[model samples]
Target: MIPTSKPHNPNFSSGPCSKRPGYELTQLDISTLGRSHRSDIGKSALQQAIEQTKSLLKIPADYKVGIVPASDTGAMEMMLWSLLGKKPVDVCYWESFGKGWFSDIKNQLQLSDVNPLTADYGQLPDLTLTNPDHDIVFTWNGTTSGVKVANADWISEQRSGLTICDATSAVFAMPMDWEKLDVTTFSWQKVLGGEGAHGMIILSPAAVERLESYTPPWPLPKIFRLTQNSKLIEGIFTGATINTPSMLCVADYLDALNWITEIGGVDAAIARSENNLAILTNFVNQHEWINFLAERVEQRSNTSVCLRLSLTDKQLKEFGQLLADQQVAYDINSYKDAPSGLRIWCGATVEAANVELLLPWLSWAYESVKNSD
Candidate 1:
């Protein structure tokens, strides 16, 4: 039987996710559209975005939050280029994005002292093996694999090295241990459901000190340079970006930020995402054919929830298409580098009711694909 109901918004893509419910382009303030980003109006809007982000996430008073270029990928690259060679590094990876970072450290940067710690798609590397004295690079959430670090308990509080995190999928929807993180990067397009091409980097005081004291042996691109003559560039954090940004995107982000605030800030947003996952959790628990990709319960991500269905690879593809054909779900297929499965965006912007509606359709799609074969 076909599911009579469907998700109100079938935009389950892991990136550039669904916008907040009741989101209207007309509601966004377009006052800064024609203004130059260098203008006082433009800079003020950018700076407000930074300040609101810091406040919502409860980032430290001493930490610096800046808007950067090229979304999360670019921010991660910039941090890697500017910081890695100064110290012996430990790069831990579980999925594609993490693997990309590890490759950058060992292959691209060609850093000789790199220590690579890895795990298959559904598992996490042994974070306990990380040396406190060596710089650490890893993702807080494995978006492709549906796994996430349970907590910052594995990180050493007394460590001499920096903890650089790619927290793109976990920031607003998850409770973060900011003190344990030295450098963190995310984008506007994740849990916030804003437009893309912009990234945010949050730097702890220790990270700033490192920037001021050390320089990478390699040449730094103008976009990646965080300091000049061993002095940290203060303007970037205060809204003077390294490159031009889309004002329309900025307005959209501001609208989303305001939505988060109105709905009880980050706590409420986290609860919404958790509830969305809970809806899927109940369905998975009752059905023997579907299971979460994450092996550990605690390590499962509430944002990018990946699942394995009892279907062949071809069947999996057909199952996803079936859902899309009925407008039940969209972009729910697993990442290309990940196993054959479904990856649902259970982020803050996604509604629990929509998730509930999506569950019955999953069973219907599975059976439809199964019977055809």
Candidate 2:
């Protein structure tokens, strides 16, 4: 029988994910909204975001975290413009976002001695291909394909080059090996379920050293510049942003962080997502028509859960629309670039009960679409 109970919250978008459980707009204190970001009132809000982020992630004591303009893309570009081209480079990519970094080095920077290590959408590349002495770039999680690197064991103990990672989708849900990563960038929208348009750039001591010691040949834009006269800008990591920021978004992020505390901390947050994925796992296993995109258990993501349904291209499109119209799920369609199927956000903010409610609806939608066709 079709399930009668429905998920109270149907927001499953990967980027701007669902907010914390029982989230309300009234919880945000927008006292700094109308004030300038550089003013003391605004800096206090910005400072809270930076410090709280460090605490929740358990980032290294020595690392520096800075707020940058745009979202994750802007923070990643800032690292490439400021720190790349100092040495030979190796880029590893399994999905679209990782491929974007490869293009940046090849087409945009036109850097010499660049090597690309790639694999199909569902699998990871050869981590051994990177040279320890050469700068390496990769994404910790393949968001579009719902695959993520299991761990950071491949990195050497004392590598000369930086290990830059686009970890927008992996930060809170996955346990990060902070020592293995030299430069990591993530957006506020992912696991935290906050507003976008602001990005956080995390720098290890090595990344900071690269910024201070080596200067790239390309002229750095004002927005991308992290150093002044060979010294790292200490102010950016300490509440002094390069440009104006929306304090409303900042306040909302603060509220989200506070909710993380109330929800039994980050471990509980990860557990919520794990439980959601587990529910989906059982559902997919029982149904012969649907299977996980990531073949290996280790590579499967707990955040963006991608599935391959047994259906034609035309049928899958109609099926997704049917699910949406039924008010059971929204944006369960796969990414545009990937194979046709379904992708669900199981981030920390998503309620496991909601994900449980979603699976039976999937079965209902599949049958309805097939019979109608």
lDDT of 2 by residue, 162-224 (tens): 999999998888889999999999998999899999999999999998899998998988999
List residue ranges in candidate 2 displaced over 4 A: 371-373
Q: With candidate 2 superimposed using the best TM-score fit, by how many Å does residue 292's alpha carbon deviate from the native?
A: 0.7
lDDT tens digits by residue: candidate 1, 166-250: 9999999999999999999999999999999999999999999999998788888899988988999999999999999999999
Listed in order, each prediction's TM-score against the native is 0.99, 0.98
Clashing pairs in 2: none
Against the true structure, candidate 2 has what lDDT?
0.89
Candidate maximizing TM-score: 1
